[model samples]
Target chain A: MRVRTESILPYSLLAPTLIFITLLIVVPIFQAFLLAFQTADGEFTLTQFEKMIADTSFADALKFTFLLLIFIVPAQVVLALVMALLIHTRFKGHTFFLYIYALPLAISDLAAGIVWLAIFTERGFLNSGLFQLGLLERPFLFLSYQNLPALFSTLIIAESWRATAIVMVILLAGLQVIPRDYFEAADVFGANTLKRTLFVVLPLLRPSLQNALIIRTIFAFQTFAVVLALAGRVIPVLTGEAYNWYALNRNANIAAAYSTLVLIFTVIATVVYFRLLRTSTAEAGFD
Target chain B: MAGIQFQSIRKIFGKTLAANDVSLEIKDGEFMVLLGPSGCGKTTLLRCLAGLERVDGGRVLIGARDVTELAPRDRKIAMVFQSYAVFPHLTVFDNIAFGLQMQSRPRDEIKRRVEDGARLLELSDYLARYPAQLSGGQRQRVAVARAIVMQAAVLLMDEPLSNLDALLRLQMRAELKRLHQEIKATTIYVTHDQVEALSLGDRIAVMQNGRIVQCDAPMNIYDYPANKFVGGFIGTPPMNFLPGVVRVNEGKPIAAVGESHIAPSVALASALIEKNGQPILLGIRPENLALASAQHANTIRARVLVVEPLGSHKLLTVQVGAEISKVSVAPDQRVAPNDDVWLHFDPEKIRWMDAATGDAIHPG
Candidate 1:
C-alpha cells in the first residue's frame, strides 16, 4: 500500500500545474482557434481568415511588425549584453547602476511609450533642446507621416529602452554562474580583455542569449501598446489590428485570426531560435 | 627561463591586508612552493606575481623587467588554478592553443606546440575531447597543458592538485615533479598541504597571517622550523608543544616540562643558559619521540590515553600531566589505550621556543 501511494505521489503533486495550464493556456488557445475557424451561426469555415487576409491593413500590419522586430530585437540584445557585462564587472557603486538599469523594468509599456513620446513630440524636450542649441531653426516636426524613418526609429528606441532591461537581468543571472577562476586563468594565459570576452564569456553565455532571444522575439511580435501610445494610427501592428477588429469593428472572428497569426509567427520565431542557438552538452561541455 | 623576484610586495583587499610586505626571490628554473593555511595570502601573493592582483606597494621584477604595473597578459607567466579552469566550450586541443592563437602565432606553430604539450602530459588522445567528457585528473592535465603550451618562463600553480582524490593527488604530484625536471621552468606553487610542499619544492616558504614565517629547503624546514607555527603546521599529527622553563643544572641547561627535566643540545643549552629560569616551549616532533624502557635518561613517564595502529607505525597519544603528546611507535610494539609508558626525547632534537614570541631560540 505504501509503495503504491509513493508511485501515485509524483502525479498528485503535478496535478495542480497540469490543471492550471489546461484551463488557462490550453482552453483559451482552443477557444481562440474555434473562434478563428467558426462562422457566426456556428458552421465551420475559413471565411474569417480569408477576410482577415483580404483586409488592406493585414499586409501593412505584418510588414510593420517585422520591421519593429528587426530593429528592436537586435538593438535590445546588444544593449542588454553591454549592460549585463558592465554589471558583471562589479565596479564600485555598480549596485546603483543595476538599480538604475532595472528602473525601466518597473515601467509599463504604455508609460514607456508616453515617456518617449514626450521627447519625440514637436514641442517636446528633443526639439526644444535642438532649437535652444540652434541645431534646429524651430521645433521641427519629429513624429509625422512625412518622416517614416524618424517614426520607426522613435518606436525602436522606445521599445528597446523599455524591454532591454528584461534581457539584461537574464544575462546578468547567467554571468553570475560563471566561475571567477576561468577569467583568472585566462588572464594568466595572456588572454586580453576582448579575447577573454569572445572566447570565454560569450560562449558560456549562449544558453541565456537563446532564452532572451526567444522571449524578447515573442514579445516583439505582439508589440501593441507602445505603438498605440506613440505612433497612434500611423503604425499598423498585428495586435493593434486585432484590437481594432475586436473593439471598434466588433469582428471577433477576424480579431481571433489576427491573434492566431501573431501566435503562429511567435511559434516560428521560437523554432528558429531553438534551432539556431541550440547548445548540446557535447558542444557546451557542461550538463 | 627567467627568475622572479617579489620585493616587499603588499596587497590589501577592501578592509583586510591580504599580502603584507612579502619579499622573496626565486632563482631561474627553481621550484618554489608557498605553503600556508587558508586565507594566509599564499594565493594572493602568487596572483600579484601573475599581475592578477595589483600590489599596493613595492615592485615586482621578472628577469630584471619591472612588471609592477603591467597587466597579467603582459607578465609572460602562466598559472594553473585550483579548479583547473579549462574552457568547457573548447576541446582540449583548442584550450591549449588559445594562448598561442591570442599571441597571433602561426597556426602550424600553435598546433605543433599544443600537440607536444599534450603528448608530454599524456593527453594526446584526449585533445579532441571537451573538459566535461574527461575525468577530474584528465581535466586538470588539460589545464596544465594549457599553461605549459605557452612555454612561458614562469609557471604559477595555486593548489593545482588540491581538488583530486588522495591517491590521484599523490600520482599527480609525482607527475608535476617529473614535468618540472623536464622543462625546468621557474615555477611557484602554492598549497596548504605540507607534504606537497615538502616533496615538490626546492625551497618552501611557509606563510602565516599574510606573511612568510619561514623559507628553507624541504628537509631543513622539516628538521628545523623557525617558529612554533612552522613547527606545528609542517608535520602530520603536528609537533607537540609543551610549556616549560629553562633551568641551569650542573652547569648545563635543562628544560623542565611538566615535572620532567630533559637535557638540551650543547648549542641549545648555551642559548638557554642566558635565559635561565625563563618560560619556554619545548617543540617535539612525533617521529622524534621514541618509546623507552623504564628509567631512561631524558625520559618522561606517561599513561597511554589512546593508541592508533597504522600499518608501519602506531600513533600513541600519551598523557604527560595536563598535556597529551603524540608518539609514533613501531607497529609491533606492545601498546594499547590505558597502558603506562615511558617516552624519551633526544637532546639534539629538542628545540626551544620563546614562550611569549613563539620564535625558535637559536644558539649564538
Candidate 2:
C-alpha cells in the first residue's frame, strides 16, 4: 500500500501540467488534423486540401513567404553575429548598447510592424527628414510599391530588426563557455585574429549556431502579425491567409489544410537542419 | 638556442605589482624552475619570458636579441599551460603538426616531424584521437609533443604536472626530465612544489611576493637558505624556528630561549658576537635534531607531546622551554605521551636570523 501510494503521488504531482499541455497543445493539434480532411458538414473528404492547393492567393502567399525567408534568415544571422562580436569586445558603455540592441526583442511583432510603418510610411520620419534636407521633392512611398523586390526587402528589414536578438543571445552564451586559456594558447602560437576566430571560435560555437538556426527558421515560418500589420490586404503569408480562410471565409477545413502544410514544412526544415548539423559537428562533443 | 636574460623587469597591473624588478638569467640548454607559493609571480615571470605578458620597464634578451617588444611567436618560444591547452577539436596528429603547418613546412617534412614528436612522447597510438578523448596524462603529453615539434629556441611550462594524480605526476615529471635531457632545450618551468623544483630544475629561483628571494643550485638553496622565508619554504616538515636572544658566555656566544641556553658552534658564535647581544631567531631542521640517546653533543631536555612512526623514521614532537620542536629518530625508537626525552642538534647546522628583519645573519 505504501509503495502504491508513493507511485500514485508522483503522477498526481505531474497531473496538472500534463493535463494543461493536452488541453492547450495536443487537443488543438489533433483537432486541426481531423478538421483538414472534413467538409463543412463534417463529412470526410479530400476536397478542402485540393481547393487549398488550387487557390491562386494561396500560391502567391507561399511564394512571398519563401521570398521573405530567403532574405530575412541570412540578414538576421549576419546582423546577430556582428552584434554579438561587438558586445564580446567590451567597448565603453557596452551594457547600454546591449540593452539598446535587445530592445526589439521585447517588442511584439505587431508593435514592430507599427514602428517600421512610422519610418517607411509616406510623410514618415525618413522621408520627411530627406525632404527637409531638400534631398527629396516629396515624401517617398517606401512601402506602397507593387514590385516584389521592394516588398521582400522591407520584410527582411522588419524581421531582421525584430528577431536578431535571439541569435545574439545564443552566440553570446557559446562565447562565454569557451575557456580563456584557448585564446591565450592561440596568441602564443602566433595565430592572428582571423585564424583564432576560424579555427578556435567557430568550431566551439557550432552547437549554438545550429540551435539558433532551427529556432529562427521555425519562428520565420509562423510569422503572421507583422505581415498583416505591414502589408494588410495587399500581401499574404501562410499564417495570415489561414486566418482569413478560417475567420473571414468561415472555411475551417481549408484553414486546417494550410496549418497541416505549415507543420509539414516546419518538420522537414527542422529534420534537414538537424541531420546536416549532426554530420558537420559530430566531433564537437555537444550532445 | 640562446640564453634568456631579464634586466630589472617590472609588471604592474592597476595598483598591484604582479612582478617587480625581477632580474634573472636562464642559461642555454638549462632547465630552470621558478618555485614559489601561489601568487608569488612565478607564472607571471614565465608569461613575461614567453612574451605573453609585456613588461612595464625592462629589457628581455634572448641570446643577444632584445625581444622585449617582440610578439610571442616571433620570440621563437613555445609554452605548455597547466591545463595542457590542447586544441579540443583537433586530433593529436593535427595538434602536433600545427606549428609546422604555420611555418609552411613542406607536407612531407611536417608529417615527418609530427611523427617524430609522437614517437618521442609515445603518443603515436593516440594520434587519431581528439584531446577530449584522451586522459589527463595523455593530453598533457600531447601538449609536450606539440611544443617539441615547433623546435622553438625556448620552452616554457607553467605547472604542467599539477593537474595529474600523484602517480601520474611523478611519472610525467621523470618523462619531462628525460625529454629535456634529450632535447637540451632552454626551458623555464614554474611550479609551487618544492620537490618538483628540486628534482627537475638545474637551478631553482625561489620567489616571494613578486620578488626572487634566492636563485642558485637546488642544493645551495636548500642548505644555505638566504632568509627565514626560504628556510621555511624549501624543506619537507620545514626548518623549525625558535625565538631567542644571543649572549656572550665565557667569550662564546649562546642562544638563550626562555630559561635554556643552547651553545652555538664557533662559526655561528663569531657571527653572533659581531652583532653584540642582539635578539636573533635560530633555525634548525627536523632531521638535524636527534634523540638524546643517539646524540654526540648539544643536548637539551624536553617533554614528548606526540610520536608519529613513518616506517623508516619516527617524528617526535617535544616541548623545549616555551616552544615545541620536532625531532626525527629511527623508527625503532619508541616514546609515549608525557614522557621525558632529550633533543640534540649539530651545532654547525644552527642558523641565525635577525629577530626584527628575518634575514639570515651570514658568517663573514
Candidate 3:
C-alpha cells in the first residue's frame, strides 16, 4: 500500500509542471503544424509548401544558415573547450576570469550583434584605431559589399562570442564531476599534460560535449536576431526571410511553410547529431 | 626494485605543517607501512614518495635518484589510491593497460601484460566490463593490476583495501601480501589499522604529528614501543595506561596504582630510578592481565563493569579505584558483569612512561 501511494505521489506532484509544458510547448507546436497545412482560405492544402520551395529566397536562406553553422559550430566548441581548461587550472583570479568570460551570456544576441557592428562599421572603432596608427589612409569600408569575408567573419565572431559560455559552463560542470583521483592516477601512470587531457579528460567529457553540440546546433538553425541587428533587411537568413514573407509581404501560408521547414531542419540536425554521438560514444564506451 | 629514502622531507600547507622533517630509509623489496591516525601525514609522506605532493624542504630519493623536484610522470612510480581511482570510462582491460599505453608500449606487449595481470588478479573474465559494472573488490583488483603492470620500481598504496567490506578486506589483505611476495617490489603501504600494519608490513613506521615515532618490525613495535604513542597505537584494545606513583621500597622500585602496588621489572626498575616519587603512567597490555582465584602478588581486586565475549576470548572491564582497565580471558572462563575479580599482571610485561612527556621512561 505504501509503495503504491509513493508511486502515485510523483504523478500528482508533476501534474502542474506537465500541464504548464503542455500549454507552453505542446499547444504552440500543434498550432504551428495546423497553420503549416492550412491554406489562405482555411482549407487543408499542400500548395503553400510547393510555393515555399519554389521561392529563390528560401534556397538563399538555407545556404546562408548552413554557412553560419559551418563557421560557428567548430569555433564555439574550440573556444568553449579552451575556456573550460583555463578555468579548470585554478590560476590567480580564475573566478574573475570566468565571470568576465561568462558576462556575454547575459547580453542579448541582438545587442551583441549591434556591439560587433559598432566595431565593424565603416566609421567605427576599428577604422578610427587604424587611422590613429596611420595604418590606413582613410576609413576602411568593413561592412561594404566588396568585403563579404569581413561581414561573414564578424557574424561568426559575434555568434561564437555570445554563445560559447553555455558550452563552457557545461564542460566546466563535467570537469568538476571527474574525480581528482583519476588525474592523480594518470600522473602515477606517467601520463604527461597533453596525454592526460586528450585521453582522460576528453573521453570523460563526451556526454557534456554531446549535449552542448545538440543544443548549440538547434539554436544555430533558428539564429535570427544577430543577423537582423547587423544587416537588417540587407542580409536574408532563414528566420528573417520567413518574417519578411509572413509579416512584411503578408503571406501567412508560405511563412508557415518556411517555419515548418526550419522545424524539419532542427529535428533532422538533432537526430543526426544524437545518432553520431550514440555510435561514437558507444564505441568509445563513454557512458 | 628500489630502496626508498626520505631525507628531511617537509610539507607545509599554508601555516600548518602536514609533514615535518620526515626522514626514513625503506630497504629494497621491503613492504614498509606508514601507520598513523587520520591527518597525521602518512598520506602526505606517501604522496611525497610518488611525487604527487611537493615537499617544502629536503630531498626524496628512490634507489639513488634525487627525484625531489621531479614530476610524478618522471618519477617512475605507481600509486593505488584509497578510492581505487579506476578510470570509469575504460574497461578493466583498458584500465589495467592505461600505464603501458601512456608509455606508448607496443600494442601486443600491452595486451599480453594486461592479460597476464588480469589472470593473476582473477579478473580475466571481467576485463571487458567497466569499473561501475564491477564490484568494489573487482575494481580494487583492477587498480592493483594497473599498478602491477606498470612494472615500476616502487608501488605506493594509500589504504587500498579501506573501501571494502570487512570480509573482502581480510581476503584482499591476504591477496595483497601474496602479490607483494610474488612481485618483490619496494612497496610503501599506508593504513591506520594496526592489525594491517602488523600483519602485512616487513617494517611498520608509526607516525604522529608529522614525525615518525617508531620504525621497526611489527612485533618489536608491539613488544617495545619507543614512545607512549607507539605503545598506545600498535595494540588491539590498546595498551592500557594507569597513572601510578613510583617509590623505592628497600632499594627496590614498586609502582603504586591506587591502593595496590606491584614490584617493578628489572627493565622498568632502572628507568623508574630517575622517576622516583614522580607520577608516571604504567602501560600494560589487556592480554597480559590474567584473572586469578586468590590475591596473587602484584594483583588488584576490582568489580567487573562489562563483559565482552569474543569467540576465542572474553574481554572483562574491571574498575580498579578511579580507573577502569580491560582484561582479556578465555571465552570458556565464567565471568559476568558485577562479578568481583582479582586482576594480576606479570611485571616483565609492564611498560613505564613519563606522564609529562608521554615518552617511554623504561627501556631507555
Please list the C-alpha lDDT of all candidates, in the order they appear.
0.91, 0.85, 0.87
For candidate 1, write residues A1-287 as lDDT tens digits.
99999999999999999999999999989889999999878899999999999999999999999999998999899899999999999999999999999999999999988998898899998999998999999777768988888888889988988899999999999899999988887777777888888888898888899999999999999898889988987889999999999999999899999999999999999999899887767766664
For residues B82-163, what per-residue lDDT tens digits would candidate 2 score against the true structure?
Answer: 9988988888998888767666789999999999999999999988887777889999999999998888889999999999
Model 1: docking quality category: medium
Off by over 4 Å in 1: A1-24, A284-287
- Separately for all candidates shown, the number of backbone clashes (residues 3 or more apart, or on different chains) is 0, 0, 0
Give candidate 1's TM-score. 0.96
Q: Which candidate's lDDT is highest?
A: 1
Q: What TM-score quantifies how close candidate 3 is to the native fold? A: 0.95
Candidate 3 stretches with Cα past 4 Å from truth are A1-20, A279-287
Each candidate's TM vs. the true structure? 0.96, 0.91, 0.95
Q: Which window of 10 residues has the lowest lDDT sum in candidate 2 chain A? A: A278-287
- Candidate 2 is scored at a TM of 0.91
Across B311-355, the per-residue lDDT of candidate 1 in tens digits comes to 989988999888889999899988878877788998788778999
Q: Where is the poorest 10-residue window by lDDT in model 2 chain B?
A: B292-301
